[model samples]
Target: MKPAVLSGVHFITGDVACAEGALAAGCRFFGAYPITPATEIAEHIAGRLPEVGGTFIQMEDEIAAIASILGASSAGVKSMTATSGPGFSLMMENIGLAACTEIPCVIVDVQRAGPSTGLPTQGAQGDMMQARWGSHGDYKIIALSPISPQEIFYQTILAFNLSETYRVPVLIMTDEIIGHLSERVVIPDESEIKLVSRPRAKGRKDRFLPFEPGPNGVAPMAIAGEGYNIHVTGLTHNEKGYPDMTVECQKQMMARLTGKIQNNLDDIIKTEGYMLDDAEIIIISYGVSARTCHTAVDEARSQGIKAGLFRLITVWPFPEDQICRLAERAKALITVEINLGQIHLEVERCVKDKVPTYLVGHVGGTIITPERVIETIKEAT
Candidate 1:
């Protein structure tokens, strides 16, 4: 099949940009629900997928949405889904299932303010922790937070590549502001866009072990109906793809699941550092808040505060080593987010008294302004 790349620049919302990214990345199946701040993504892809001979299904709900994506992916198709906080919560069980069964799929959570349906249209980074631990268990996940329409486009493609490479559910954790905001996005040609396909199982079908890992701790997957002995279950299973309830089997299975991503941190973790070379106070932020933090850092620099900005593009692996290195050199660390102290705790953990850590955040329904971030920077100094 010909690649479905719209090779040009277009002014579009982040949600629309994301859909285009998925299409460019060769995502052939999208199973999603209509949820606020994220519905535009589903709407755009639903129209576009059919044009490329892809499938787009609006499931009855979020749970079924994710389940269907997993099914499609197991059939050797690149699949994805998009939702907001409530819908994301509903998909948690299946998210874990995707992780346990080693399925490749992307989940986009365009976050809105919420404990439970708190604000449908407002933006918040409250789901940072949930994106990491929402699914029950000790599996590792990859999550990217985008600050703009252009970035979300690239990040969505990256999300798919990572999911396929590691055989895990990757998340694009955008917010209402970024999702609804429109800007210029450059869509590269099919030849220019990098795509990663899942590693397919090779060797005799009769001798194939579905869950056996290679040197990288990632197993080559076999699609259903490929004539290989494929047995997939959420329960602990052996390399032969049969359930094994022994503690040793559980230990080995868990290690491969988590180790695949953790061992490849150099490739998976991405962050941007601004003016960090000669700064005493560092402001760490992600998503929409990072934009404000950048402005605040510039303002602080104008006032001779020696401040810097550390923006997280990949948030899930936590980027502990980089944060720790920055903490050791900087006098203080400030974490800015729309939610109250979710990523702040992570900063504090990394710092561990190496430097004082401060949180400049608030409850959702509104954004944290540059002035407020500047004020916190001054206070820290």
Candidate 2:
């Protein structure tokens, strides 16, 4: 029998690393429909899962794919699904359902350029805003950007831990570049890796309230067949998990749904800063674009430009306060992203006219090179 962790060094694409990462994190169920740039993950995990005593299913489509994961997660299994642009769009409605019902699951979106199937094979980070707002209504979700195959592995594990801890869906915001790029990923022993399972409900099953939050503002989850009165729904619910459509129920439910994530931002968000202490110019980016930012920052510094790099590991919460602090002291801020200007607007919003903000924006189908970023730095000055 194959080991669950698949411990050791290996050369692999980011997609395979992601599949291995999910297994290492104790993910037992994967439900996805094959989609371009993201289908390899489902194919890889499908074979590996059976060896590890897990389940993998290819549903009718992306909608059913995500719906299956939500149902699987409700039964107290760690669940995930992967897709590209069009499929990701199809999963939005059910993604919102996961949020409303506080189901712990992960969605891997290896984004391709698109408003509607713009590019299938080419890479793009065009899904940044959609990851946060694609699902309707007001909900707080976590999204992580991995710079490489190695980091995507770790980020995948982190996604599961956070979902279980917060009882909310987490997103791995990857792109086709990193998703298909080959790299060396070191898989350590299972003993060294950290894993988190959902907070299980205890005490008498008769009085169990599935939606009632514990001390951390996140409710303990009751499995579907665990004899608990689990009443999961997408509608406004009271602590008893029953539909409560009144004003008080709406407000109370909304508060916890958003607050559980907002209140715990410190734990959920992760970012990296380099050469920032005395920076007059700040270049912000994430995912594969961030790989170029690293070189761009070095090139700027070599040219005697007081530039620094602020790479976002977690994108959804937006890192508003951190960007604001940097903006206050920096002479300028530049956002590098493949989208025309999704994250750039957020950076400009956080700057609040404090600094002259600029965007090194790209439409799709390519990467913004370090030289292009340096050119923007010269222009910003």
Candidate 3:
């Protein structure tokens, strides 16, 4: 059967549409502190949640905001939180806790100029690395970066699905430019979207092991106070979810935590390519910078330059294989971002010195222009 038509679609800011996407994905619990660019996400959800009989809490700070989302998720509710750079940093500890405890939740980071609140309301793509490893630990995280309001809507849903499927926090690494810019977004119907809930343990409900592995590597999550004596903590624990201090237990637990993401990377990774086949140079980017890069690629092609474009929809996991393949064919790899070359390093790492990579970046409130990217491509050519 064909999917049902989704009509009356219109564009809006990525932040506004992301909130709606969370609602459509059945997010009933929102705990967020207001921050620039991303504040509208919380504001939109705060208004929408009440109409759906859900709970929306403006916590004291980003720390408490993330903690509340974890608490809500443990109670078997689909929950999420949104923030900008500094708030994202504040939530890092609890985000690591969410990683350790395997809590399924979505974190929307509408990135802005950073490194100590550089520009609160302004745009920047400075937090790409932070989104991957900001939390203090040797753990893997799933991060998605959308290029448009339409993608923000769909990626928000994907974030929740991935979180639930793997029982780990998923970050929607949005940028301020896309977050604040309004565009037409066609909201898909609920029935058409594939929503996956965490598997619930059966039988021995009274003795359910919340950390026990299931078929999908995700353990069955029994809600707190749901008549299941489930134990949850941030410590390294055995299958019972208690703190374990032994070396073997710690290794195994860490393995499970990180392995869930690494083992299923193919399902969690997403990217977009344009004219990559037989192209000489491939410009890689994400967020709003990709918009500029796309135009640059077009102009370069018009100028008889064989330039391709690769946009990362899933930022984490880094699209290493795709990058390696494209890098082998291209003379140079140019990474375009709205900050001081965060993801450019990843591109370099993937190519492993096999390709020369150039960083095209900006700071403060400046947006990287298409002309600048075109010039960079011409120089490489």
> Which one is best on lDDT?
1
Residue 19 accuracy (lDDT) in model 3: 91
Write the residue-wise lDDT of candidate 1 on 1-381 in tens digits.
444888898999999999999998889999989999999999999988888999999999999999999999999999999999999999999999999999999999999999999899999999999999998989899999999999999999999999999999999999999999999999887888899999999999999999999877889999988989699999999999899999999999998999999899999999999998998999999999999998899999999999999999999998999999998899999999999999999999999998888998888878899999999899999
TM-score of each: 0.99, 0.99, 0.96
Question: Residue 30's C-alpha lDDT in candidate 1?
Answer: 98
lDDT by residue (tens digit), candidate 2, 1-381: 689898899999999999999999999999989999999999999999999889999999999999999999998889999999999999999999999999999999999988897999999999999999998889988999999999999999999999999999999999999999999999999999989988899999888888889998998888887788678888889999999889999999999999998988898889999898998889999999989988998999999998988999999888998998998899999999999999999998898998898899788899889999999998877
Name the lDDT value of residue 59 in candidate 3. 98
Question: Cα RMSD (Å) between model 3 and the true structure?
Answer: 2.8
Better of 2 and 3 by lDDT: 2
Error of 3 at 280 (Å): 1.0
Worst 10 residues of 1 by lDDT: 1-10
Using alpha carbons, what is the TM-score of model 3?
0.96
Off by over 4 Å in 3: 1-7
lDDT of 3 at 278: 67
RMSD of 2: 0.8
Clashes of each: 0, 0, 6
Misplaced by over 4 Å in model 2 are none
